[model samples]
Target: MSLAEKLCLTAAFVFFMTGLLTGIWKYRCMARSENAVAPRYVDIAHRSSLMYSFAALLLGWFAGYSAYPDWLNSVAAASALGFFALAIGTYIVHGVLRDTGNQFRKPHRLGRSTLPAWVIHAFMIVLIVAEVGGSLVLGSGALIAIW
Candidate 1:
């Protein structure tokens, strides 16, 4: 397998494991809650990790078929994978802290200090660009190779 494929598959496995662990955490939270509901962020973390695992698998499949060189494909895949990991990690943090249900709500404070709205918006912009741009690169390469 190409380096990009290996990297993506590895990430998929890690994400899947994280999802499982988070699922356990969710169960624990639910058991402790009077209403038997897990914290919103814990559920979000579990769901996101599971979804990202499949997304990583899709990326791996594309990377394997991509016409681009290994280095280029790896770089492109890494961009998206990195963001996916970052997002999952953030969710896990919020789950642990039982923080705001919405990270983008008014004030937007994941940390002690209220984050500026611009920073949150900027992060969303970069995340969209990285994930979409990187997927386009690999997907286009795969299409080119097949056609």
Candidate 2:
């Protein structure tokens, strides 16, 4: 496998392992809760980790099939994978802290200081662009390879 594929698949494996751990945590949290629901962020972390693991697998497949240079493919895959890690890490942090269930609510706060709404909006915008743009790059390369 190319470096890109290896990188993506490795990340996928890590995400899968994290998902398993988070799943156990979710179960424990649910057991402790009278309402039988885990902390919202814990559930989100578990689900997102699993989902992103599959996404990384897909990215690895595309990377393997891409016609682009291995370095370029690696960059593309890394871009998306980086964002996935960031999001998962954030979710895990919130899960551990049991922070606000909704991070986007009015007057957002990272910890003690209030976070500007635009900061979150900007991050969302950048994340969308990076994830979609990177996938498009790899997908286009794979399509080219097929054709």
Candidate 3:
């Protein structure tokens, strides 16, 4: 496997570790008080991290199967990894800081009006486009190779 693919798999492991930590946090919160519930963002972060990890693995495998150029593979892997970290980190921050309420259930007002929110959303958009666009190009190249 290429270095990029290896890195993607490593990211999957990291995300799993993050989930484990979140689980522990939840357990502690429950132990402290029967009525205490783990922060919504923490739960969302744990679950989404797992999903993103799987996505990273799938993208890595697709990149390898498609025999994408080194540069393209690198870009796709990097974007996937970047998005994964950003998502998990944001979740952890929101959970720890408790700046907003139940982000999973309701849209935060900051997302609609804040400059920082706009920058973060824009960055996520760019990463998604790069990762998906690269994957499509690589998949097409593989199809052409087969034909």
True-structure RMSD, every candidate: 1.0, 1.0, 3.7
List TM-score per model, in order: 0.96, 0.96, 0.76
lDDT tens digits by residue: candidate 2, 9-89: 999999999999999999999999999999988999999999999999999999999999999999899899999999999
Compute the lDDT for candidate 1. 0.91
Residue 126 miss distance in model 1 (angstroms): 0.9
Q: Write the per-residue lDDT of candidate 1 for residues 1-147, one digit (tens) a residue.
A: 999998899999999999999999999999999999998889999999999999999999999899999999999999999999989998988887766889989888675667889998898899999899889999999999999
- Cα error of candidate 3 at position 83, Å: 1.0
- Residue 102 C-alpha lDDT in model 2: 85
Candidate 2 Cα deviation (angstroms), residue 61: 0.4
Query: Considering only N, C-alpha and C atoms within 3 Å, which residue pairs clash in candidate 3?
Result: none
143, model 3: CA deviation in Å? 5.4
In model 3, what is the error at residue 49, expressed in angstroms? 1.7
